[model samples]
Target: MRITKTLWNKASAARLLLYKRDASPPSNAVRVLGAMLGLQFDFEEPDLLQMEHRTPEYRKINPMATIPVLKDGDFTLAESHAINLYLLSKYGGEQKEVLYPSDLKTRAVIDQCLFFDAGMLFRRLLEVSQPAFIGKIDSASSTHIRNIEEGYGIVETYLESSPYVAGDRLTLADISLGCTVAGLEGINIQ
Candidate 1:
């Protein structure tokens, strides 16, 4: 019974770690990471080293000096999607079977959504939200709104077949859309 209890506890812990509320990345990346790990999160202000990206000190930790940098012990990694996948793999395990998908065929579909999320969805969202978030509503553009709508329309079409991009599963694709669409609503971009 003790061994059984210990195993159960470890499994639960791993499951929890799979999706913790992280604040380092923009809400977009956090949402993707949460979706990939099958976790929900609330956005918060992150506690980071106070320095500019181009600073000499920061470059030692991240030569690229990007905003969303992940330092896991000695292994520091970059790239938003790559970091999301790494976090899922490190913490989610078999529970992430649906999100990450072990099957090559299923994985391909998830990959397509991930790519779209990183490319078009993010692009549209960033362009639309930048002006508003920075307190410059006048900077918002109809072109940005159109771009965002196009991506959202694609997601709507994809949703018609499956509940999510990976078909009947609330995969990382859902998380990406959820985050992106939510941000759009926040900025009142329609």
Candidate 2:
């Protein structure tokens, strides 16, 4: 009975970890980490078309109404970059060092890459997308286009130095940037 209880608790924790209130790469980043770590997920995707994210209850989970709100037990986390670090640290176990290394220099480089994605790359995506979401424009404006291209240039510069976004190996920064890049490509961002 004691062992069974322990198994149950572990299973419960994983289930809670898998609980995804919103969808997208930010959320997908966490899911990818979980998947790579061999954890089972229970995705609870909300309908964005119907404004499901703006509901009162949904707002309780994330007042900002952001995608990929992760609910683990009683703890809720927002922001893809933050969640990636938290999940990687808490559940990464043996794989933590591989994904997010411990050395300060390596970790600092990784942190810089993540920051680039969140502040520059991902924000550029949002700038081009929000206007479309509200029907303010049919597509990205010239300035938005320039901004997107500028973001691509930044990524290119990062790769010119190393194979990965952070260093020689993959890291949380790559996961977050990959998702944002995919979204841009899906819209034919060139």
TM per candidate comes to 0.70, 0.86
**Model 2, 142-186: lDDT tens per residue?**
888899999999888988999988889888888988888877785
Query: Which candidate number maximizes lDDT?
Result: 2
Model 2, residue 172: what's the lDDT? 85
Candidate 1's residue-wise lDDT over 1-190, tens digit each? 3454224322343322221224222345645664545553322222333335557875775686654555554566655677667667765666578577888988888889878887788778767555555566755577877787788799898888887767887776666666666666665644
Report each candidate's C-alpha RMSD, comma-separated, in the order given.
Answer: 5.3, 3.5
Clashes of each: 0, 0
Query: Cα deviation in Å at residue 102, candidate 1?
Result: 1.5
lDDT of 1: 0.61
Return the lDDT, model 1, position 56: 81
Q: Top model by TM-score, which number?
A: 2
